[model samples]
Target: SQKIEQNSEALNIQEGKTATLTCNYTNYSPAYLQWYRQDPGRGPVFLLLIRENEKEKRKERLKVTFDTTLKQSLFHITASQPADSATYLCALATFIQAGTALIFGKGTTLSVSS
Candidate 1:
């Protein structure tokens, strides 16, 4: 069955360390993969997107890796700070007849403290 899942436990880390998260999928081939960060009360904000043909994508302190064969993605955040703490979500972007949209995972929360 087509499915997407992320670690349910909240990730706690000390400020200045790197935070790593994982996203795994099965029974589906996505054309694109995207990562977003959501604040407590606000909606998710886009972080990065990777195409199926691309092995990885990066922007500043963020990095995303996609493996088509494994149907998985890994998201990373470097120089983690308290301000960077948030619920991170991974989505599979596919072109459905409905339109181009994102199917997001439940999300994984990261807490960074001194």
Candidate 2:
């Protein structure tokens, strides 16, 4: 069995600052880790995905780092704005494990205030 953990608590950051979120897993070595953003009253929106083999991946102001040895992944949002505020989730693709077993974290809410 695999266990994925996130802050479960909300993160507070000011606008224009860099918001860093963490995801830690144990009892499993997933080939890849994925990040998503969920706004109130809506489904999660995919943000980024990093493979165990990848050191870091970036797109625009979003960046993700996967450390297989540490069994952790870091998600960053640069120049974060108030609009960026949302609950971020880390998930593992169950399909990669066996057939299809999507595992998700409890999610960390980010509050970016201007």
Candidate 3:
């Protein structure tokens, strides 16, 4: 069976520091991996997408690295601030009877203190 896991608890940190989050998985080979940010009572916005062959991907203050061998992904937010506080989700595309849909983990809530 396929499984994904992210930090279930909220991460509290001071502003201007880098916040690191982890995602792990098992029994699945995803064609690509995606990260999204979700605000309260809103849908998640796509952040970065890393392909199976890509080692790393970046956007602004965010950086993501994928290790297919270990089946893990790391997400980082640099110079974080209170505005950066949100729940980050990791998702992978899965093949199903009806084509494919993204399989998302519970996500990790990051609380950046000002």
- What is the lDDT of every predicted structure here? 0.88, 0.90, 0.92
> What TM-scores do the predictions have?
0.90, 0.93, 0.94
Q: For model 3, how many clashes? A: 0
Deviation in Å, model 3, residue 51 alpha carbon = 0.4
Clash count for each candidate, listed in order shown:
0, 1, 0
lDDT of 3 by residue, 1-114 (tens): 468899665898999999999989886778799999999999999999999999999999999999999999999999998999999999998778888888999999999999
Q: Model 3 segments beyond 4 Å from truth?
A: none
- Model 2 Cα displacement at 30 (Å)? 0.5
lDDT of 3: 0.92
Models sorted by TM-score, best on top:
3, 2, 1
Instruction: Give candidate 3's TM-score.
Output: 0.94
CA RMSD of all predictions: 1.8, 1.9, 1.1
Error of 3 at 84 (Å): 0.5
lDDT score for residue 94 of model 2: 52
Q: Give the TM-score of candidate 2.
A: 0.93
Which parts of model 2 have CA positions greater than 4 angstroms off? Answer: 94-98
Candidate 1 RMSD to the real structure: 1.8
Question: Least accurate stretch of 10 residues (summed lDDT) in model 2?
Answer: 93-102
Best by TM-score: 3
